[model samples]
Structure formats: structure tokens, C-alpha cells
Target chain A: MDYGEADRILTLLTREMGRISARAPGARRSQKRFAGRLDRFALVAVRLSGPPHRLTLLEAELEEPFLGLRDRLESSAAAAYVVEVSAALSPEGEAQPRIFGLVLEALAHLAEADGPPSPDLLRAFELKALDAAGLMPALDACAACGGPLAGEGIGFSPAGGGAVCPDHAAADPAASPLSPADVHHLRALARAPLGEPRADVGRAAHRRQASALRTFLDAQLGRRPRSAAFLEQVMET
Target chain B: MAEADPIRRLIHQLSRLPGVGEKTATRLAFHLLRADRAICLDLARALEEVSAQVGLCGRCANLAAIDPCPTCRDERRTDDTICVVERPQDQWALERAPEYRGRFHVLHGALDPLSGIGPEQLQIASLLHRLAPAAVREVILATNPTVEGEATALYLARLLKPLGVKVTRIAQGVALGSEIEYADQGTLSRALAHRHDFG
Candidate 1:
């Protein structure tokens, strides 16, 4: 949650609240406000007042805007992606305080590292979004058995919201099955904080998590956004 | 409405579906309420059928209605020329390339050890079985040009070589629009190595 080396202003799109405008009011002019200032990916605090529609900023202080992504390209897109989704999913004028914090955490982690960090950040954001939206999957006890979820092999059913225990497996034969480790990996992402969480686990697990999330998203969102496809194409190229 | 209300819960579920926005979900929920009871039941039945019936192919491990899958079941397909690919989609991509009339042996996915998807996990065992028949002349590895795909192809080549069947890798030629003059060294080398035998 540190947005050091920058103190500017931004009109962030909150997933919980609609497009809200806030100004630092000489934030860039002073060192104190500038030190913890707004930058891309860094999360910031803002004071504003408006009706149920318009958001106006009264005062501003940068919390963390994921300043690490200030230069790179890939991480920037990743940051933009989270932002875009946050913007799209957020209601026009409601107090989604939790989503604001969650988004900041997600973007900060993606930009914190120098290189192409494992897509762990993206997955975490996605899962967190689901959680904040009250769509977090049940992964610990069997979705069916209410027993522990241990063992070498497990299965993923995106439609089922998590691993289907031996007892409560998906009724659909076409349920996208996932491995046990994948479920564990997903659980880790879901539980971890957005900043510097355990994302660099393995490629297979990441892919599995990604695909599972994608299916869930498609099912929920009704269609994959162009941004998701753009990310895939970029990775493929 | 209250946060815990069941009516709100239904709206939430509808909004979660693909293409169904909050407005649309609300509209659909109302539509179902007024529509014939049987229509809603039909929709529910379709959902049940797909989830309960469709599963991955046991041999190639691709999604299908049956265990062995349609591709593996077809006896008319040539057992000799097994076209290896990464995913089921890639198999379909090749199917569109009808010139390759031989039967296909999907790897289910390419070997990506970094992700912990080893040769052991993919349908490599089934692929090995396809090679046991003596009539098999060549196995063409058609993975993508990506690092993981190349790694997968190399792994397969090494594994299949021991079987004594002629193991070959498909070459990626420069695009039709490219000229030999502008081709990179790697592409130029590949073009030279895979030059067709002219009469």
C-alpha cells in the first residue's frame, strides 16, 4: 500500500461506486502528499461529496496505486484490466468500500514486481472480485461431503464453484474437472492478499486456475470481455 | 429489498450468468415467471443433460460425449500417421486442413513441465500405444511455435524415437506473404532443411 515517488491525481473507477472524481488539491505541489501520492496501480484515499450519481473529490492522499507499473507495458495492461473490470462492474453510486480496497491491493501487487510476474496477481484479483461480489467458491470442505479436501488428485467444477467432493460431484458430466493441487492453488490465491502473495507457484496450476476462472466468468458475465481475449492474445504472442 | 432476501438472491444468480446483466436478469426472471412452466423446465433439463452426459475423452483426454471419443473410435483412420497436437481445438484446426487424412492422436496438451504438466500426465501413454503397430510410418508433431509447444514436441520426439518408428516434427514455414530475402536466419534455415524433393 505504498505509492512512493509520485503525487498526482487520478479519477479512478471503483467497482463498488461509480466514476468518482477526487483531487489532491496541491497534492503534486507538496512533498508530503506527493510521497504517498496517486500513480497508476497505487491505491489512494479521497474525500468527496455528491448525489447518488456524481462523485466529487474534496481532499486526496495516495495510499498505493501500484507505482511499480509506472514504466512497464505488460503490467500496465494488467493494471488497466483490473481497473477496467472494476469500472465496469461497479454500480453507479453505492458504497462498495471493500471493492475499492480490494482493487487497490490487486493493482499494487501486479505493479510491485519489475518483470512479468506470474499471472497470480490477475487470478487473485479475479477471485477477489468474485468474493467481493459474493461469488467466492467453497474449496475447503468437500462441496458435497463436508469432509476435508486432501489427497493427490482433486477435481474442479467451475459451475459448481469449487472442487466437487466424491459425494457431491457435479451432476453435469461436462463439468470442467480440476486437479486437487489446482483447487489448492486457487484457494491460496483466493485467500492471499493482493500484494506479493504466493503467485509464482507453477504454470500448469496457473493455467488451470485461469481457465477455470475464465469459464466461471463466461458463465457469469454471459460472455468474455474483449479485454480477457486481449490478454490471452498478448500472452500467446 | 433487504440484503438477505431470497428474491434478491435470485436476481444475483441471474446477473451472474453470461450475457445477463442486472437489468436483463431481472427481465428474464420475470419472463420465466409469466412463461409456460414447461419452457423453464426444458431449459433446466438441457442444463442437466450437458453436465451429466459430456466428459473428457479417456484416450486423447479431449471433451466428448463418449469415453474413447469419436476420433479414436473410427477404425478407418490410418493408424500409421498419427498427427500429434496440443489441445482438442488444435485437432479441429488440423481437421480443417483436410490434406492430412491420417488419424490424429491428441496429446490433450503439450508438455509444459514448468506448470507441472509432465509427459506422464498428458495422453502420452495412449500415443505410445498408437505407435506399437508396425504399419505406422511417421509421427508428425504439430505443436505451436511457442516455447512450451516446442518443449512438448522435443519431449515427444525423444520418447517416440526409441520406439523405432520414424519420428518427424512439422516445420513452420515463413508466411506466404514473406519473401526469402526478408526471412530471418531461423526461418531460412528451417526452409532449407525442409525443402521439398523436386523431380
Candidate 2:
């Protein structure tokens, strides 16, 4: 959005900068200056000046406009969801090469998706983001009891940080019921490489995985990512 | 002390406005102090009246003093063609040309998901409401030619196309009198994409 008449405040997540907000004056009206390079979700290389607390964008070179995601609603929504999550996970003024790479890769997949980007793509990003943020829960074992989570009727507890066996699940108040399929999907999401194609899961199972990850991510962040609501709406359709 | 206190308060308030740094605010404050007392009082009254009286138009969501703004109520305007803008300022920009003689719908903002602004946050529902009763045949999306603006236009196109109404995007091209060499690549590309045949 525009901060002043001609200037704009851009929130960008960069590999070296982590998350930064820079001011680009005359970005809105000046065709020769930034030259439409400051659009959202477009990867660009920028030269910045000013103090560490406040940076002014001096120049920008458009590297990837990601035009495919910009035109489609579902793809745009997916990009938004991933960007929001990346912003939430990244701390300002710190370099996070892994998270940045994750976001760039996810956005690439989203741009190319014939339909809405696979829920697996977002889930994988989330799981990796949690790891990068040092919040990777014990997916293999019970989060609370540290026991094996090896059976049907398991539950995933966001409050406790991961899946729990029925024993600890019964004790945890915030545990959401997870079917065997949901657990398998979550594990695959955490383990699969970016753009990995696994067997297609049922819609019900997909929704369950998304809901569980959303809850877990919200618990870690202390608030649901605002983009998650729109992402949910887009995915529902 | 009383006079100094008021002056200090004025500078503080003025500095809060966008683009008004403390130095500029102080300069404005001193200027106002040196100017006629009537000017200061008149400025204060104008601000108060604007806040007290001005409100959004019920139909178009544009800032106005009346329930339905004059533009909304203007019988001369055609309901069949509605120009959609992201903000009231954008609507004014289009009206400056004086060529578009249609009613306006202000979205108040664009569909920026990263900022948590979605269809619900904007005046999309009200737009649909306006379309339901009105003889709206064409919706001219005059949103700024930015990424968010394009996404917003595309989103609206998808939403409004189903209603069987014609949705059109304003043509983007090099500004009049500007050299083609100075035009940005994106603008030039779009201009070429939407090129028209010469008479």
C-alpha cells in the first residue's frame, strides 16, 4: 500500500535481510524510477540506503515478476498464505537463507500450479519453517510423553507442539483428533522435499492436515496468520 | 505559558499527519501563530466541521457529508456504467478528466492478502448490492496499475463476469506527451498488448 502520495512502504522477506520494510518514494507515480518493480510477491534485487532502523529503496531490479500467480485468484491466495507464514516465522534484521529459499521455491511452485498449489507445498513450507524457527515439534514421537505415536486414533496437539499418542492426547485439552491418514499426511509434509508429489489424499484428509498445521502454526505464533483465513476460503472452493 | 502550551499542542498534532515531520510541523505552527488569529480559528473550525459532518456515502462508500453523496444522487449520471476505484482519491483522479459520466464505486482498498485485506474488508458486497438493483451494464475498473490493483481487477472481473455484465480494465499506456523511450518496460508492453488500430 501507499504510505504517502508518491512513496510506498514495502514489506519484503529477503534471504540476507530476513524481513525488512523499505520506503520507495515516487514508486506509485514514477514510471522510470522503480518502474513497477515493487509489486507484491515479485522477487527483485534492490539497493537500499539509510540507517539499520529505516531503509530507503534507492533502486530495484525486477528478477522475477511471477506473473502467473498475480492473475489467478487461487494461486495468488496460496502465495499470500506462504508469504504471510514466511513473514511470521522470520525475525526482522536477521538473515534466514533457508526460510527465504523455502518461500522462493514455494512461490515458484504456486506460480506454475495448474490449479491451486498443492496443500502439500504449503504444509511442507510450514513444517520446514517451524524447524527453521526452532519450533519443529516431535513428529515421530509424542510431543508431550516422548513415546511412539504409532497407531490409529492419534491426536495432534498444537498446545503440546505435535502429535501425541492416545494416552497423552486424552490428557491434553487442546488436542485435535487426527486420523491415521492425517498423521501420515502431516509426516509426509514434514519429510517431503519441496514440490514433492506424493499420492493424492482425499479432500477430507487434506482439510484435516491444513487445519492441524494452521492450529499448530497459530499456537507457535500466538495468532492465526491473517492470510490463513483467505487461504482456507480459497482452498474450500 | 498558556500560549506556549497551545503552540506546543498544535505542533504535536500537526506532526502526526502523514509526511509532516516535526520540523515542518513546527514551521507550520509558527507560520500560523504569525498569521491572522482568524486564520487559526478558521482552520480549527474547518477541521472540526469536516470530522463532524463528513462521512462515507452509503451507496458508493466515498467520503461525503450526505447519506448518499451528490454523485450517487445525481440523476444526470448513468447507472449503466460504474467506474470502480480503490480509493476516493482515485475516483477524484478519474473525475478530473471529466470524460467518464458514470456513477462510481469506491472499494476503499484493494485485495491485498498479505495485509489481511480481503473482499470482506473492501466494499465488494456493497458493490454487488448496488449492481443487484441498478441497471449496471458495464463496470470500468479504474484501479491503479499496480500488482495489487491488477489482482483486484482480475478478482472483480471473475466475480462480475458471472453476472453477465461487461467488465473492462482502463487502458494503460505511456502518458500523453511522454517519450516512448522513457516509458517503463511493463507499461510499454501493456500498451503494445492493448494496441489499437489507427484511423
lDDT of 2 by residue, A79-188 (tens): 88888888888999898898999888888988888776887788888899898888986678888888878777678898888889988888887887787667767777
Candidate 1's C-alpha runs over 4 A off are: A1-50, A54-67, A144-153, A166-170, A197-200, B1-199
Error of model 2, residue A102, in angstroms: 0.8
Q: After superposition, how far is residue B127 of candidate 2 from its true place, in Å?
A: 1.5
Whole-model lDDT values for every prediction: 0.64, 0.84
**TM-score, cand. 1:** 0.42
lDDT of 1 by residue, A1-237 (tens): 111222233466655455555444445445433433343444555666766344444555644434345334355456556765665556555556667777766666666666754677777788787777676767787665566666644555566666676545546453455677777777787887765456366777678778877777566656555456535643543
Q: Per-residue lDDT for B84-106 in model 1, tens only?
A: 88888899988898678787777
Could you say which candidate leads in DockQ? 2
Q: Which stretches of candidate 2 lie over 4 Å from their true place?
A: A1-9, A23-32, A145-147, B1-4, B36-38, B178-199
TM-score of each: 0.42, 0.88
